[model samples]
Target chain A: METDLGLWAVPIAMLGGAIRVSTPILFVSLGETLTERSGRINLGLEGTLVFGAMSGYALAVMTGSPWLGVIAAAITGALFGLVHGLICSLPKVNDIAIGIAMMLLGMGLAFYFGKPFIQPVAPDLPAIPLGWWSDLPQVRAALQVNVLFLIGLVAAGVLWWMLKATKIGLTLRVVGDSTDAARALGLTPSLVRTLATAAGGAFAGIGGAYLSLYYPGSWNEGISSGQGLMAVALVIFARWNPIACVGAAMLFGAAGALGPALQTIGVSSGYYLFYAAPYVLTLGVLIATSSPTQALSGAPGELSINK
Target chain B: MTLPKFSRRTFLSTSAALAAGAAFGPLPARAAGGMTVGFIYVGPKDDFGYNQAHAEGAAAVAAMDGVTIVEEENVAETTDVQKSMESMINFDGASLIFPTSFGYFDPHVLEVAPKYPDVRFEHAAGLWTEGMPSNIGSYFGYIGMGQYLNGITAGHMTASKKIGFVAAKPIPQVLLNINSFLLGARAVDPSITCQVIFTGEWSLAVKEAEATNALADAGCDVITCHVDGPKVVMETAAGRGCYICGYHADQSPLAPEKYLTGAEWNWAGVYPKMVQTMLDGGTIPNFLRGGLADGFVKMSPLGPAVTDAARTQFEATKAEIMKGGFQVIKGPLKDNKGNEIAGAGEGFAEDDIRLESMDYLVEGVIGATS
Candidate 1:
């Protein structure tokens, strides 16, 4: 069972595992950051993620093109988000409640439709080998980054730039900051928020695609494992910043990779505890950063969550 | 049926009669006019994993003469499952109920069984004690036997002499399968080793995939898993160009060229017999266990990737296990931690509670229990 490699392998494996594991979280949290920035919370992205996973995998299997599957997943996610946005726009409708209901609906639909795709294998997304210089097989394998991870990194930068510099970004910020201000400015807050939510859903759909069409690369009911929901907490931890979402996601992925990394180095005691490292770290971050008496810094003023 | 207004003495007499009936009278049958069986699954009916395995079993029983089967899918192991069972008994008039999830046994089954004494409850993958209720019985397949067979194949095919296992938890059943797989591998090549990773979830696809990749990166040439569903593991490993073995169901179709063999549940072989035994008014044993010999477990057909030598060795090992007196958890066994689990010539019988409660990995298993 012993590998001849020295002690340096653990950190190297974790770095690679972090990149692989964090890709989904990065995409999902970035999506949530957009939605929350526009003063809405889509708790139902969990469902969207699963639905996207199913739709993405099923389409890849049917179409034999992984990119097409990703597009389909994004479209499906956008549709789910559009539904949530339209429903929540009704007078006196609670977005949080609707988000929960939509989550169940999305998951139910995915499971119902995903049954046939469970046993079939879908085509995998291609990966870029980045470790050609390394002589060690472990290093070479670890550095084989998936294409989606690179896309997610680019998406993070683009989202940050768009949210900060674009006119659409100003409109979303104004609407999220104060609905009354937006109405006075002749802009419909609901419409802006709805579009933002849809875009968010689209991003989450890609995250789901990453889960089913790349890393795990299979369609099943248990594909997402609450990563969609975890992105909500991750967004909060990132102070609703898209760039910070990437870092936060990498932190989570690194924590998740800790157990396997340690095992590769033959440090296997309390393995289950290591599995819980991500959650524990998330909890610790939340407790340390949260203020009891004041709204969180950088929180969108019109956002309904936790207020 | 209106109740008659009764005087105090009449009420007392009626209460006494009811108490006497409850204490000494034969329990009424739960089913009213037909044999109705109910199954509750923790996942969708077609998950191609543990739940699907049970669903297939329920379908088999449904095919039996004069038997009707009703199922509630995606039921969690909570009070919600208890409610589903009650409704099946009350509305569907199901006499026999199978709550197939592992977590359903402790509080849910134990709490519900006493409320409906006439209804027989069969739980899968449970540890039943002597003091447990008589109406509730537990059964599980010896999947380790099939896993061992797969291990022999893995042992022979692996050029690296390192195999990877993606396991769900550190529970005894899972540990037993892991150890047996390693033992079977080492039986062929004494130097073979298995590197295991527990994903901490029964059906988390992403984690299972990551673990599979991690193992492959660590130089394991062959990979198998004890996850609730083997879809992601098989797919990930195969996509990574690694040879794969599966669990819970046959997954060769997922990756034909990379597929080896899988440890599959043969619940269809046992469910009909169980239903028949119940229909014939026979008591099901409190602790029912069976293996490949009795058809409760099976091996998926070997794929083209499997060599003829591995196939021969696997078949011979399987036959030896089927002939009885072949114990996988035998003497001179030391845990991965170097502690002697069983000294030379000292071993627990197959199906022994000690074996059932296995807590350590055998030697050459590169994994931890905690």
Candidate 2:
């Protein structure tokens, strides 16, 4: 039985678990990366994540197409972002607090709208495995990842290139780095932030769709633990880079799956301790990478928290 | 039945505060000129658990008669419930309102029920009646019956005589299930010991999976849940090979290898009767408790894999229970401690105690407070 849980099992299970669990985190972090790229932070992304899960699941069941659930979730997420943008854009409203309120509202809306889709059957996302080259069953199983994992990776690489080389990416980075600089250059910071936030919202929505349609395609109020909120911490860990976001999210996924994997080996003591793995890792990495005075590597200069 | 001329935009607007039209089942429409009733929910109507059952029941009522039910889903706390109640009364003309939440008891409903004497109200899962108006009454289910059956299956499945239960709050409704599940499992194995973990939220699939995983680690082969969703439980056990029983619905399809069997409440058996009674010019009977006799509660489809030994014993036990010849909470009881709960030969009487306030985990349960 001990052989059943060797170092190979842990890493192999983690590879599969990371992809399964990291899909949502990748979407939300990528979304946050876009919003921050445009000189704004959407703390309300957490609410958007859950609400999207609820809305996406409900719509998929009602519409009879899971892909439509993804589309519906994206629309709802964008709308939520639009509302947040509108609220923050208003004269004196604080974006942070409005984000908190939007979080509450988004959750409330999800719980309300998502009520019916809880038990209904919806389409499940198809997983694409590239591990066929591996002769080992465990390695082959680990390679049985979802199409979204590959998409998330591609999105990260594409987003990284876009931010580094594209005109739109340069303008967004400039807006985030300095609102005054953006204004001096004849670009509206608010406009850039708003559009960026919309993109972020779309990502958050897709992230929620991952929870309902792919990781486990079905609806329930309990479907989301705190993947949305945790994505915020993940974004900080990623330093607003989509590439880093994938790595950090997979790490968190591995941490999240630790307890389950441990059970297979018959280690049950201190089970509650395992529940703290992700949060602990997140905090540890944040503390390790954080500098009290120096600007974080790759962090946007104009960002308030980063500075 | 008051249908204030249906303008297209205000099709659901009856005068209730935010008492918007809601869907029950496959169909959703505003009751144009139908006697509009209002239903207020503490959570979403599609929770696939308790809330879903109530919503389905309300929807069944809407299909028949001078009745149109509008639900305000995801209404906030008691304050919001009260505000929604007012909206149902003063804003929308809800002659009958169902406050389908456990917390909306004395403070929310009792305070408001008397003022709105014209509106008939039904408080789900409430017992207080001191300040309640004549128009209001409370009702609930003997969900313990289903829990008991589930425990019997757990007893059958546990090779080690060890099982786990993941619950929401330690409130009476949940405690009742824990206690009854123990009784049922014990009735079969007599040696089965159940350990329970609380997640504090009916929903929270992640925490639930974590908790269940912890239970699986703790050596529980048979797991049962009193949560809002079954997906997490199903998926977590799918790979680990733990046996699972679900609440609210049969999720055997979600994880066939792991899903042992589940117990569910059938609103189909109860809603039509209540609606028919109301249509026949009678008020919904106050505090009506329904059981297997009335079909208000039902066991979900037993998985094809349930053993003949398990099935035979379950059917016999169910028949006795249905005939009222057996009560899971009946005599020869003892608390978790070795102390005798009842007199040596005595049985606990129903009239002497309230099942909702039970906090102790009888014998054979390894559970904790809060």
Candidate 3:
């Protein structure tokens, strides 16, 4: 019997928790990285993410296939992004303000439509059991990483490579660095930025899918919490790098898992305080790395936040 | 049906009427025609948890002949709830209102209850103290008794003798439940220990899921929680093949096979009785409280997995609670920190007011309050 795990369970639990917790954040932050790289930011990804979760869960429950639900979430997320992109591309529209409005709209719609699906059970995303050789059940459980997390890892690497070596990535960078420069080079900045933002929304939608179909795996109004909004800060902390987003997301995941992991071994006195670890880690990293005099390194020149 | 909307003109006129009523001593209680009762929830009504329990109550009340129930869901604990209360009073002409969420009591209910002295305000959980508005009343059930019952069932069902509790916050109410659960389990098997994890938010599904998995990973064969929405916790624990003991509402539908039993609020029985009292030209009690005997709380039917021994023990303990003066917290008790909770020859009874300010997990529970 593995009833008395003692202190050894904390690290193993935290490791499993990190992968589970970080997957959604990683997806959203990577999506935001793509959008921010093109000189536009979709703060509305929070709304899109939540909306995606609802749509994904509802679809998965209907289709009886988790993969179909993921696809449905991606499509809906892209549509939300398209709406954000189309509105932001208009003259005198503030993407930030529109993002807030879209967030409220998305949440409102989800709450209204999601009322029916709260009780129905949806099929969950599969996990790959990597701890086959381990005799300990804790080790086996910890190593059962979800497939979406593995996909997030590959997506991060691919996004990083595309941003550095692809022509499409170069067009995005050119449009993001200078609208006039891109226009002179016969590239339409608005069209490129809109597509990039939509693609980013697709990624965030996938993150939302991971949330409802895996880890906490249920359809409810409070499912996302502030994971969507947190990804915005995460993008900044990652310095707009997809690869860095994965690391930062895991840091947050580990912090989130810390309190619960300690409780397993009876270090639970101040367990509630541990939930704040992620936010504190984010604030600490932001202060330690940011300087008042310099523009943030690797920041998109035409990004609205920079302006 | 939609709750009556407050137009700008209606708001101004209602404000004037309220101001005038405040100065003119008190408006006469409206006892004519059908009465409007407003119910406000901090989350969606179908959340399958705390709000759902109250919503079920409201649904029962709605079926009454002369009662018109108006409900607004997803009302936050901020001034937004105050606005909802005022709207229910003004636009909907609600004579009595139930701001059911606990957070709505402190400033939201206290702030709004005084402004409308004629309308009755009932809050869930007995937070009403003297010098607060007389119009505002409090009512709650001793659901800890239900948790203790759940603990008895869990203790018998657990092969590993490790029960897990996923709670939200370390408040007195939650701590009391944790202590009672451990105590009940100890009654069955003295060596059984409860591992508790507080997720901090009432409805943070991700953390609740993580906590459940963590408990299951640590070899807890049975799991329960005090979170507002137990859907995620129940589903996750059942997914990992752990026996689930639900809270706030009946969750057997979520985990049919692995569910042991649950602690559920019987607001359906309590709410209508209170409404009927007011409807019959009677004053409702300001500090109404009860347990299984009074129908304030009820336990879910024992699951198919429950043993005959567990069922016998659960029914016996429940009868004791219903018989009244049943002391879950007794003499010679210590918290998880090895500090005394109840010294020898001293203990808090089932309805002890002192238990409301509980600040420690009892001995045999693996958790801390701070």
| Per-model TM-score on C-alpha atoms | 0.91, 0.74, 0.95
Winner of 1 and 2 under lDDT: 1
- What are the lDDT scores of the predictions, listed in order? 0.85, 0.74, 0.89
Misplaced by over 4 Å in model 2 are A1-22, A47-119, A126-172, A179-199, A220-226, A237-299, A304-307, B1-37, B129-136, B157-162, B212-221, B231-244, B249-261, B266-290, B330-346, B349-354
DockQ values per model = 0.46, 0.21, 0.70
lDDT of 2 at A155: 91
lDDT of 3 by residue, B139-252 (tens): 999999899999999989988999999999889899989988888899999999999988888889989988998898889989999988899999999988889998999999
- The 10 consecutive residues of candidate 1 chain B with the worst lDDT sum are B25-34
Instruction: For residues A1-307, write the lDDT of model 1, one tens digit per residue.
Output: 2255657767777787788889888988888889989999999899898898889989999999999999999999999989999998889999999989988998899988988887777788988999899887777777889988999999999989998999988898998888999999999999988988998888888899988888777777777878899987799899989999989998998887788767766888887788888999999988998899888899898988645
TM-score of candidate 2 to 2 decimals: 0.74
Per-residue lDDT of B226-293 in model 1, one digit per residue for the tens? 87777778877887678988789888878889988888999998999998998888989988998888
Clash pairs for candidate 1: none
* Candidate 3 wrongly placed segments (more than 4 Å): A291-293, B1-32
State which candidate, 1 or 3, has the greater lDDT.
Answer: 3
Q: Could you arrange the candidates by DockQ from highest to lowest?
A: 3, 1, 2
What are the per-residue Cα lDDT tens digits for candidate 3 across A1-307? 6645678788888888888899889999998899889999889988888998999999999999999999999998998888988999999899899889988988888778888988888999999999999988888888888999999999999999999999998998999899999999999988998999899989988988888888799888889999999988899999988999999999999888888888777676676567788899899999999899998999999988889
* Full-model lDDT, candidate 3: 0.89
